[model samples]
Target: MTNLSAFLAQNAIKPDSQERVVSKRFVDPETKEPMKWQIVAVDSDRDEALRKQNTKRLPVPGKKNVFQPTTDYDAYLATLAVECTVFPNLHDVDLQNSYKVMGAEALLKKMLLPGEYAEYLKVVQNANGFDVGMDEAVEEAKN
Candidate 1:
């Protein structure tokens, strides 16, 4: 095949799907290492669903408890994440066990600390170019 033909054959992707990776890394407290995540891009339909899921109004006024129907903010973003990779000097097995233990919240706590869920939000958005709160009021405004 011609070089152009060969390159296209190797690099081309199916139009139906796109791939993206997190622009930043998360630090693992258990292993004291940094890890990165990757994921596939969701279409506009999926984005709309996420927007709806994250925009739930508070059931009662003056109550912001997370347990209630208050906005999830970025929970939808987390659902898009597919995998995470740790930085050098950390064994894969160790990280794997921690994945079994610390889970996403603990890992994010270690990675982002004072930023907490905000950092997790950043990781998910940066990975797939999602902005969680950008449309928090779109539905109500439309109605």
Candidate 2:
């Protein structure tokens, strides 16, 4: 038995934001140190919206006017990374222009190399609490 008041909006605990050195190439001019990127946990509502935006409707075979919704996982991750990134301002037009990219997702893709991008995606997932699995959690609990 738990008090329902604890579930109230005001009583909710907000997710913590984290900063990680995503790239060593982007260094501070004065300190000559790697720059850190700020990432935050995306709420479920926003996550759902991003997912929907990346999903496409494909025509189903043998059925006229029938469509099946398919989610583009790579596109969704790129969008999620863009949304969760608080620093470097991926949405900035100037940044996009400098990278010769149009959208935030494109800007992110252009900013990092392939390997860096993949690692950054892992960091983003960790920040969003997606790095944990139920099996691991169960194992840890039993220990």
Q: Which candidate has the highest TM-score of all? A: 2
lDDT of 1 by residue, 42-130 (tens): 65687777657666654555756533344454454444332222222123446546655445434444444455445545554554554
List where candidate 2 sits over 4 angstroms from the true fold: 132-143
lDDT of candidate 2 vs native? 0.86
TM-score of candidate 1 on Cα atoms, chains taken together: 0.36
Per-prediction TM-score: 0.36, 0.84
**lDDT to native, each model:** 0.46, 0.86
Q: Looking at model 2, report the run of 10 residues with the lowest lDDT sum.
A: 134-143
Candidate 2 residue-wise lDDT, 46-104, digit = tens: 98898889878899899999988877777878888999999989999999999898999
